[model samples]
Target chain A: MSDQPTPTFISLDDAAAMTEGTRVTFIPGLQALYSEALKNVCFVKGISLTRALHPPMGIDKETGEDRQARLFELTSQTSLPTMFHDDERPRNVWIEQLALAERVGSPSAPALIPDDVAQRVEMFGLCAVILGEDGMVWNMRIMNDGPLSRKYGYNKTASAAAPAKVAEVIALIDARLKTQAENGSAYLVGDAVSAADIYWATMSMCVTATPPDIMPVTAQNQGMLKFFASNAKVPAIAEVLTPRIEEHQHYILKTYCETPAVLGGDPL
Target chain B: MSDQPTPTFISLDDAAAMTEGTRVTFIPGLQALYSEALKNVCFVKGISLTRALHPPMGIDKETGEDRQARLFELTSQTSLPTMFHDDERPRNVWIEQLALAERVGSPSAPALIPDDVAQRVEMFGLCAVILGEDGMVWNMRIMNDGPLSRKYGYNKTASAAAPAKVAEVIALIDARLKTQAENGSAYLVGDAVSAADIYWATMSMCVTATPPDIMPVTAQNQGMLKFFASNAKVPAIAEVLTPRIEEHQHYILKTYCETPAVLGGDPL
Candidate 1:
């Protein structure tokens, strides 16, 4: 388990007082790839966090207002993983968080982004493939939504493109692994672990779909997890994911994400 | 210019006759990124092509039939750049075409895919980012549609995400260039020009719109090009296109795309 203090999470209603000096994030998806990734990054860097619940479906229980709408009002986006720090500007998006991990992290918990210019470029490029709109998670979401649409709701034509897009991304990650293997280093960019590694390690769960033991999601969210897991289980896409990636996943969980990522918490 | 013969294109009706021995592609957008890139690949490899027009708007003027529907009947897809060859399965998508370019290309022309496994994987991965549904062109299209929705017609929410997605893709290409600069190579993947180079050189026109003299489009298509250029012109994405990418563009165009890409061609 990471030596960092267990993060104190607050209800959205209680977030006002905590926002004064604390680092806060409006987060959702008790078991989301992006959400878990963000929490893991905080744990690795030993950055204490105050989490404000942005419910998975965007609806908050107390306010009955769409948390996504609230997020958009504050951060101009509905996406999760928005970090608000004291005094300085709010950091949104996965890339910004990676950079923040570097800024706030001590020497012992070094930044995931590499120092080499080329590696940095590679890291950013890889992250874009995973985090960008047409990226792995986005494709995975579409795949999840497509099936769910029949049972719940979706745009069939648009969602039809998800599998191929997801396949393309997984192939890219596999290729990166091949290159890393040739270089005799297991990491994506260079010899050391970088943001690319962290992002992929967590985001890849969109495909591999780990059990609840490590990434603990509530029973309420189990259906959503199945959606993600089934999306990843597509044969063509799943085949592209070599054992090399699973090795990285194991390494990441063992090293940085050993602490169980349980759902829900009390106010600070 | 590539030493290959100037290809003779045909209408959808004429495509049936040439299906026996000739390599054919269901193509649209006279100066379209995918269409032109495919043509350039064939030209470089001395592979003669029989082109069948897939009307950009998906409606055929001559028969008043939905061309996309017609394409789907042939290949189960409406996307352009689908290639039909003699006695083999149809090749669709950019990845398939890249693989085919190697099989059909001559010793003199050579495949655009790199020989190095790592480079090949990178090339495929990068190409996926371009050709995949969420790649640059897809994002550009959405951004174009979003603004055009007020003036023309489009899906607004989908289009809103375009600029950022396009920016992410452009950033990746720029990062590749930076890494190439370090290795003393200008190409996106390896030392030699690969399919990745050709695809970007042409597809990027969707962003950095080339002048009419080189990539001549119909007056009707001019608006589309403008939409793409303006989308690329967004500061976040435009700033990523460094001098290195420009150098490669110049190299690809001077070497492979010297002939003006006029808007339409006569049927053979």
Candidate 2:
């Protein structure tokens, strides 16, 4: 770890040079929880990542091409975080990233995926719901758009249905946490920390911001927090973002999330 | 009651002449459940109606104008089942129709809107959910459109969320029914039949087709029944359209809905 307090974010041009080692394409912001979580997983596994820049919603100034288009060329999908590992298949989704973490992790490191088959099934099922097209994040994006913009993008019926859909998933997660509490298990699946817990804790980074040390809270992230906080006005949204859920997320972060890796540009 | 088995559908021109009594503007079809239910209300009230034709999805050949445009001119809205009573204000919505039924119903007829305020509130709330934009019907419409057409109408996120939204409302209705069953009340609200029962029964017309004698099932209606029935493949939709719900709808039609009126036209 460098003595420097701030991490500097590297440009895509700089990142393009590193093809031999672990390379990750990510945007540094509260919204980039999936990317950050993946980075955290790599850190825990003692895998060093050469951080790459991913611009938000526009063309990259240096490249003069759509940043998203470049990202698509790198990884088949546009959404971050995109990972490249020395002549290996590029990993785009969080699940694939988690699998990679487990494969290369140091022998002393704890397994993120459960050893038991039934527990693995349950954990993966919940993760699918969280990451799937019809899952929490997708549904939240639908609800996030303002009513007018939502109508044009989503049909009248879909605009009408978005909130309830988000609520249902939130309720599912909340219920799982409640059950875990009742069973005296602090983690999402079984008694130990798993990818399910990490994924959930990080996914809610915007909704419930982690501490400044683990994930820096910036002005942009503040805006995200407000966006998530506003959802609390909706009763169903409020029900799932309960104290218990927040406590569980914080607990996972405290136990598993180590000192933030210095991925170079001024600590996001 | 007349022994005539054949049901007569009225023409627009003939129905137009009678302004002295209850006047209903409706098209004869399974889709015209709202209008049909209102007509049934009038029949039970012993209030004679001059049934008029409302053309489906196109211009009226006789008027040389859009049938829906004409309806909008008359009622400020194009949705079917518009009603005009003498010089009284036109009643377009189910709520207005229910109010009209209560005001003009015969002394011998059972009340549709419950007298109790709490019961009325509960009934209306449920009705709003069923009929509102986020309700089962609207969500069903969203899901009903083909995937290609849906892209233009609704965005990806909204499209994905539609099924769950429909499911939530279905679950709500199912839960209410379960509670009612536990309490030994066949009706949705209090013991006796109310607008809630009639409205739900009518709304679920496609889900559970009415008997041949009461609501003649046309080819389109049969298709609609199939559409609704197919939704049973989804567990949430299947839960609402349960055997108990079907039985309840049939009970309402048999007990409350009476003889088909002779408004003078070929059977629809």
Candidate 3:
């Protein structure tokens, strides 16, 4: 690899524009995991089929039906986030989610991702919704057609990550953390911040803001903007959150993840 | 028994009707549960406020402002749901929320909303979502407002229950059920379907058909609802659900819940 790394993505859109694939999911293994802002989840889950595909409902190029048919099918399934059937959980999400379980023997274990082999086994029991659309591909594409979803489009197909699912995921994490939170801890997995916490800190960017240089959105996250624009307390949380978020991004996740190729060089 | 059963409602020129009370919440417990349709949540919620208030927003004398404002405040904590805080969550909603958690018992207890508990207690976690608001005398006022809430125009308040959070809730629940579902158990809760299942079932109303009888409107539920109609799927779910839901006349909740007039003789 060259020392300069020949920065690949000039802009966020440039990365999304590289769409060469038929299906795109949240960056594999990099889904977010926060539990605090459950009340403010609206801000995090701004990505969705409706918001992404607001105006135009296209027709599938394949079956030749209203594109919404598949979109709704996938959207409904996804809306409930059936990423994996109880019997057919997508290995991709299940495997990654399982990584969070208490694993034993694995060197990666005890790194806030679980060290208990039993917990690891139970992860198969954990739900990590899927989005594969010979049925769904069209609607996500339509989301890209919108000015809003297009603004944050991703994957080679430049498909818009369904904001609805994103929010649902945050709520899932929040639900997972309610007990943890009832005890009073901002983090998810372990005593400190776990992969779940780090994940939320990272993914919230799709809805909220990240460093201008990183997420590089022209706007601060959407629903958050609408909220804090009117409400006062939320902005206070942002102030405390934004910088610590950077710390987690740098010190925690940065240790594992690479900069998205769509964005630029290797992980920052 | 008095001849009058169906409660009264207040109307607005711009939107749907409201309950006798000025305050209202279109959340799962109150409106969506009874209606079995998410399309008219805003309107149904509006009915609560209308019935409570002497006048509706922009239409009549202002009476329900306090209720509306407080109800808004309770669910307005962070816009993030207390439960299920994943960043991958969806937007348009149905159910499975955690943000507005109601304290039932121990966190390690595994289950939520035990069947033996009273309705308010069973749904206590969700009901607590309203605690943040002022429910003193207004609780009764809210109770009384049901008839007025169901009449003219409401459906615009927009609860914390967004479309995205609904998706995340379903996905998470689906994930939770993976093992059992694989085991051939169809329900999410116990052998039959508990409040948890009922909540999801009620929330799924977001996907149900909102006939005109329930969501009476000036402009209509949507431009072309025939294509979007949920059909028997919506009613079918209602059949398996608790008897609490009243599809036609909302007086069950209005008289029994809001005012104790037994407008629908809900057997409370």
Candidate 4:
């Protein structure tokens, strides 16, 4: 076999082969990484990093160090998830991979993550982590648990962290992405697409759908929409996700969303 | 002839092609843009831009936005191009482009520079700008006149005020690329290559050659090497740019240093 054309490891990057084995650039498959006693699974650790770059912990380019020092004091008091540990169990593989990458110097570069870029990358990494940790499992969760959570979920909201307003979430994403598209700057920056864009895009699929026309879309939305609608999920969930959260939403809507619908499949 | 297919625009990614133009992307053509005069270039102006973000400015992750603030202030202090025109020569097209990009919003977003991926895009853009500005013509002057005097050259020493120590410049770029490569982070940030990496690679080539084995060797080197070796340059330029000073000299010596001698075409 070694002499005769050994099968080289090749990761597919196309629409049809959704299989986890396929090396989806910028996308990782959680199920493939998990087996029987799946522990130490890490995901969404960076979702909040973007916001973290805003105040004290994050250096404000305008005010200088004094503002950073003060911001640090404020953030220190708050219970923020600078580094989030997904779920009750630890996904050993991710930890091992991270360690191995660290040892091999193949993990993402911490230095490359300049102050601003770090915040953006961390947030995006979290999005990737979540997608990798759960993959379609998230879709299943939304399909199965979403409606039940939404229909009976009502509680008194108090304090500042009263969960993000769903509508605001959508609008925020819309505004950022719209600017990104308009400015021709990939992410929030000049010409590069930061982790924020990727994270938003990935996590976003959990809430909304990619546009079909210029992005990754498929023939799956019909039934998928019905499934999501019937389950109805959390109102916040619906409120947070909308039609054009990211320019790529159209792509997802067109590609992945439609696949299941054409196949007459449901979230389950 | 008119119907010769609407000439689809493809993305060129090859280092050389991207430096100039290829299939999928059209960059490195900043020189061409200068010749073509891209009008009304809508752009996004980023507030907290940095070196990894903008090669022209170098890195500035400091909390005190003093440096960038000064840069902004300098621009504000004087009109575009420092308004030192002799009331005759038509404005420098390259400067016009830069000013135009800033005016229209930066031709792109808030985070115009992406967080991670390939580092070549920004470098690529800057290369275009440098080429567009006919930086070589000025560099040639830097070689002959040093960093002083008007007849010394055209265009402010791009980095005139903040001239990098030859060794420091070399070390900085080498370290930047090496660190990124070691991390498997595409050596640049974004969905693809950034102009920053291209700038480093090209500039580095001007100073020294790498191990042909390590770096894909091409005949384009001879012309480039000869250009730098010409006594018509900076003493620091020659000293720092010599083959002996090359960080990858051994890599080149042991691998591809002389391999190009056997090749035919120019080391473009």
Best by DockQ: 1
| Candidate 2 chain B, run of 10 with poorest lDDT | B259-268
Model 1, B88: alpha-carbon shift in Å? 46
- Tens-digit lDDT track for model 1 on B15-106? 63354644545444346567678877777777766777653444678988875665554543445666766644455556556556666767
Interface RMSD of 2: 20.8
Candidate 1, residue A160: how far the Cα is off, in Å: 1.7
Residues A1-268, candidate 1, lDDT per residue (tens digit)? 2222344567544553344543545443345567667777777777776777653444678988875665444543445665665544455556556656666766788667554434554666677667754456766676645432332223576478777767777777777788888989877778877777777888887777776555655544566667667866788787787787778776777676654565553211
Task: DockQ each candidate and list the results.
Answer: 0.02, 0.01, 0.02, 0.01
lDDT of 2 by residue, B180-241 (tens): 98999888888887777777776766444445565544544556556656766665566556
- Per-model TM-score, in order, reads 0.50, 0.46, 0.28, 0.24
Off by over 4 Å in 2: A1-4, A13-17, A29-31, A59-64, A146-156, A209-215, A259-268, B1-268
Ranking by lDDT: 1, 2, 4, 3
Q: Which candidate should be chosen as best, given lDDT against the real structure?
A: 1
Model 4 lDDT tens row, B11-34? 111211222211111112121122
Error of 1 at B263 (Å): 30
* Model 4 chain B weakest 10-residue run by lDDT: B47-56
Per-candidate TM-score, first chain only? 0.82, 0.83, 0.35, 0.34
Off by over 4 Å in 1: A1-8, A13-29, A55-67, A146-154, A265-268, B1-268
Question: Which segments of model 3 are wrong by more than 4 Å?
Answer: A1-57, A60-64, A74-82, A87-190, A194-196, A207-243, A255-268, B1-44, B47-257, B261-268
lDDT per residue for candidate 3 within A92-169, as digits (tens), equals 122222221222113432343333322322221122121111111222233335542342344444343343333333
Error of 3 at B16 (Å): 20
